[model samples]
Target: MDTHTPASHEVKLSLQTDLTPAQAEILDNGAQQFLEKLVQRFASRVPQLLAARETRQAAIDAGTLPDFLPETAEIRNSEWKIQNIPTDLQDRRVEITGPVDRKMVINALNADVKVFMADFEDSFAPAWNEVLDGQRNLRDAVNGTIDYTNPENGKHYQLNDDPAVLICRVRGLHLPEKHLLWQGEAIPGCLFDFALYFYHNYQQLLAKGSGPYFYLPKLQAHQEAAWWSEVFSFTEDEFGLPRGTIKATVLIETLPAVFEMDEILYSLKEHIVGLNCGRWDYIFSYIKTLRNHPDRILPDRQVVTMEKPFLNAYSRLLVKTCHRRGAFAMGGMAAFIPSKDPERNEWVLNKIQTDKLLEANNGHDGTWVAHPGLASTAMAVFDGVLGERSNQLDISRSEDAPITAAELLAPCDGERTEDGMRHNIRVAVQYIEAWISGNGCVPIYGLMEDAATAEISRASIWQWIKHGKTLSNGQMVTKALFEQMLKEEMDVVKQEVGEARFAAGRYDEAAVLMSRLTTSDELVNFLTVPGYEYLS
Candidate 1:
């Protein structure tokens, strides 16, 4: 369904759909020479990385417990810290994350936050148009020309003269950009996003006294960090930029990454900036990592808050580790999108304020907000704690008590309930429909749910059914039970969204896709893989 043709240069672009000249220009800007070089250098290495992932997954499937790498013990025990973080990346008190939709990009940059992580991963549904257009928007943003006009209200949006620091989050290592191929294989979406952005914007940003900053996603091993370091070095050499110009914040989203935190930091120390509390994916990863252990099954989604033993250990350990090693410790998203109801908005903002207060008190340098409206409320919390200080890396919270493996793997106590099961099914269906329709982040039940939360929702259902988890109502969760629950939830969704929009978004197909994911005999590593197949 994609067509290839030369565009503004010798390099051929695989065009999946027709593009306007301006859109084509964004793609063609430095795309020719840059993409060719990247494809030639990194194409062969994609398989090796993916194969390594499978090997680790196979071990998990076989009930092998992942531990700190023995070979990297020396690195972990060392007193070394990551290289100095840049000024712009130092005090990320509030970073708003979203897909690179034009309006979202404009609003996030002008949201008066410390940083804006323009996301190409969980927050985005990577259809071909979305990917290309996202790149264009980022370029335009860097150029200070990105803007949007609301067709409904005739309102215009643009960046502030002084905007938030921009940090781009590329696709995770596991995703493949099926639309683009090199050496007879689809290139890794991570590579495509990183290479294109660095190729086009590294020098441009450098001219403005900033550089290409990034948030690395879903890395399960330190080798992936090392691989990224090599890529950064390669980019610097190829582009004639200074070494260490590219700084990255790694999302400790996977369970294995939690155990290997020190090693991951050491591996990419020169290029590392911070460690983010990628709470949602970490929850999904916890379930997947311990899939073979029926005893490790989690409770209802609502009960698995960060205050739980396992989550608490993870957060405390991250802050301690990053601070001990002289790096910023970022907190997770407060996924509340302000509602239209004043009472609801006030309640949600108050909840976010308390959540952020915990992070700030725990010594997190910054936190994330889903909506622009919550930025002020979230920032007030961090600003109170971090008064006149860029970060609390000077505070050594680990000195009193260090985190142990047992604590990180501590089991939670709660009962699975019928309400929880139905909630997961409902969200899985609604979020998937939105994602399939090219909107990855959708607020349901007052929480901004993205692919990460959807993964948790669907994967929990699969795990519950696989382990025959019993609800509080004395009903055992089975495939048939889930199917029944799913149908009931579909009716709820239809009633909520009404007939026309639900049909337009193709919720029927999304329901079938979600059902397949939730009831499949084998677990799929990432739902986006299958979900993307239905796009375009």
Candidate 2:
């Protein structure tokens, strides 16, 4: 990919390759200049903060377990609250999330949920065309003009009269948009997504009585939240909008971030509306952050549900902190999709009901569902709790004693078996294959699986191998054992996917990547970082 500069701009914005006419319209001269400004002003801080992450991780590796910050104790103890929530964002009972494809945008907007998070992060593959096309599709949706017709079946899709409130989830700080470069460096993917979306559709959103809303993913610390706050303030100033026009919900998905929730909220209090339980990634973060600790190894991913002590502590603490700060405490995703068989579908609905009930009872103002079918189930749970109230923010958990770090880091109880190990290998390989093939969200074995869940699959295996943990069958987890299981799982995947589909997919490449990740001396920070090279 050679870089070519546009003639109309003085800024050094360059493209990896020439854009099509439609793509050019999305990244026109004004948008390019806005991106260049963002890159020049804020891009340097991304690497610095990422290095801070490593430094903190090194401390943890050297025997310093995370605790609430002493320096920021005043922030936690003092009384404060974020800016008020937007009118449209007040009652987010059930939010449906999906990739930003045209059909998904329309259907999600038309779903029974109160909000639809058009995701360019976990649920998207970030292929160049997908990245640009997502912005175009979202722009059309904001204008209430987006529509789609299935090319295969000719079934039509369009937004409903009262569609769900739209929110965009951009790529995390760690990801880079390799398709575009500022000076010689690739642009930060989050900045590109945010700047383009805000530039293109902020006016329409405001005109329609909404603003530029977003979901900030994978935040690790208050300092990172401070950086995003600066970006939000800068964008608002650039557009001559009000200070808090752009509201965000930060995903407290990392172990370190859990220890610093108060500080995180304080840092972005002007722009943040709430913090979400990105449970899948939180589990992945637990294994990754505590990888060097022998006693902290986790069991099968399926067994580590939210009811586990550590996760329960995390959820309870999130609700307490958010409500205390006058922000909504959104729940985690209910990733089940309805099955075709009646019995199985009934089981799926029951599971979703149980999960959503837990969140609603725990004081979460809202929850997430991956499929439209699960929306009604989640809504019923929240509806029962909320009654006519917009949210459960008024239901505080201050009566309970504070959640301690020990409880938050307690060892999860579960048994690891050969079946679980095989399942991990199979799901990781298949998800990676699908991700490389331009699908980041896929249903495997009934549940909707995304990058965060797949991260847990591989990270748990790596941690197990690192600690030489034993499975329930009395077999020690080793590099050799994982390799053997991977081989068996690949064969199983082949048979399940069939010869034609298996031959056509990138299973071999995915297997190689998975093997490298699980066996490497150092845990990779993110699978997508390396896998991004294979997106094209």
Candidate 3:
């Protein structure tokens, strides 16, 4: 009998090999001495492979190791490490400026935030190259430099070297469009592009630990988190920073991550300084993951279940997980953006109260705001905490994108007019409506719905506005404008679509826009008025 072991390039002969008379004749003629050598070697080592197979089977049978992925990395508890200095809104709050030609950032910074984030991932309509360029601009923005002006009235963008704080949201992990953007421009990979962009552009702005960082998007799978950690940590090394020095905020937006929150935190605890629940994605997750389960659903989403027992429980768990672990459990966004019309703003005020009540019970330490208008509201609501002696972002208020409402509204003509504001608002509203009515498969005016379409209109449009879209109509909505718009539209949306019906885990019109709104400054200001004090 003859057996052979395969070389890296050659095939192996079987362990038990018997040659017929004709075969023996060929072998005798020396078909290949290599075959004989391989057979002898493999015969001697066969026992080792068999033992390995038996051990793996035994581990599975004993339920000690996963039948699959037994060799994967082991899970471990994570640590939190981000500097959080609490400052009053009046004392300090950074703004979001530039690109939009709006003073939203400067105003916000001057008005009520402890930190300002220049959004790129969910705001800009960065078709690949645009993303690269936008990021470079953001790098400049971080250092108190940006070619910016208020597009509406010809005001200039201004940032102080001593600005409160600045942060940015990069393209979510593995976003396919990033690849398209890079390749179309003859680059190899978007990830590489992003990392390089951060490196080369910040040549003059390098800080010992103060270089601009990121807000991660679409972070669901732990592997994805690990992948990003690797990329970020690697980038830090290449850029000449201390290992693990880069800080990030995680926007939990997928089904698996919501349910696996504990593990996700443990996986990212070390690098994650802040964790925010993403409402649109959270609802999307509920629909995508929990809706299928009959026992865990709400009677409908229209009933307002962001505070239901289940969500409350989950939120509490997230808050506890983050807080107990020393991480900042950041509350999700308040898309209602306060309204100018006090009545409508009052309604959002009602929602914000509910939102605040739920958040307070959970152990969250901070909330997000989308507009400068919301800054005052956030100040009023979080005044107690902001006024407190400790240093931390006030979690008492709230913080909070999107496709064309018409799916057909071209992004914008770059001109300025109040009508442009109406157009963009209408597009956002239409997008929310269409997504709710199941007309989400395609743009309201264009092509069929698929992954590409969803990404283009749904994801792309949202990012564009986030980055600060200029309208032909002359009106604008910026991260700074979010609060102002919320107040403006709160009444309009509620009055326009009365009593939205959501099936527990479904994304009704309200849920879809719950965290994606930016109407007119002053997000649900009612949260701080007498009856809303509990919101804080």
Clashes of each: 0, 0, 68
Model 3 is weakest, by summed lDDT over 10 consecutive residues, at: 527-536
Q: Which residue pairs show backbone clashes in model 2?
A: none
lDDT by residue (1-536, candidate 2, tens digit) is 12223246575878888889999999888888888888999999999999999999999998888888899999999998998899999999899999999998998999899999999999899999999999999999999888999999999998889999999999999999998887788889999999999888888888889989999999999999999999999988776777999999999999999999999999999999999999999999999998888888899999999999999999999999999999989999988899999999999999999999999999999999999999988988888989989998898899999899999999988999999989999999999999999999999999899999999999999988888889999999999999999998899999999999999999999999999999999999999999999986
Better of 1 and 2 by TM-score: 2
lDDT, candidates in the order shown: 0.85, 0.93, 0.43
Per-residue lDDT for 172-264 in model 3, tens only?
A: 433223232221331112243344345433344344235444567656555556555665665555446556455666777654454445455
Full candidate order by lDDT, most accurate first: 2, 1, 3
TM-score, every prediction: 0.96, 0.98, 0.54
Candidate 2 stretches with Cα past 4 Å from truth are 1-9
Q: What are the clashing pairs of model 1?
A: none
Residue 386 alpha-carbon offset, candidate 1, angstroms: 1.0
State which candidate has the highest TM-score.
2
Candidate 1 per-residue C-alpha lDDT over 18-128 given as tens digits, one digit per residue, 9 for 90 to 100: 667866675564665567667777667767877998899898788777777788778878798888898777778889999899999999999969899999999899988
Best by lDDT: 2
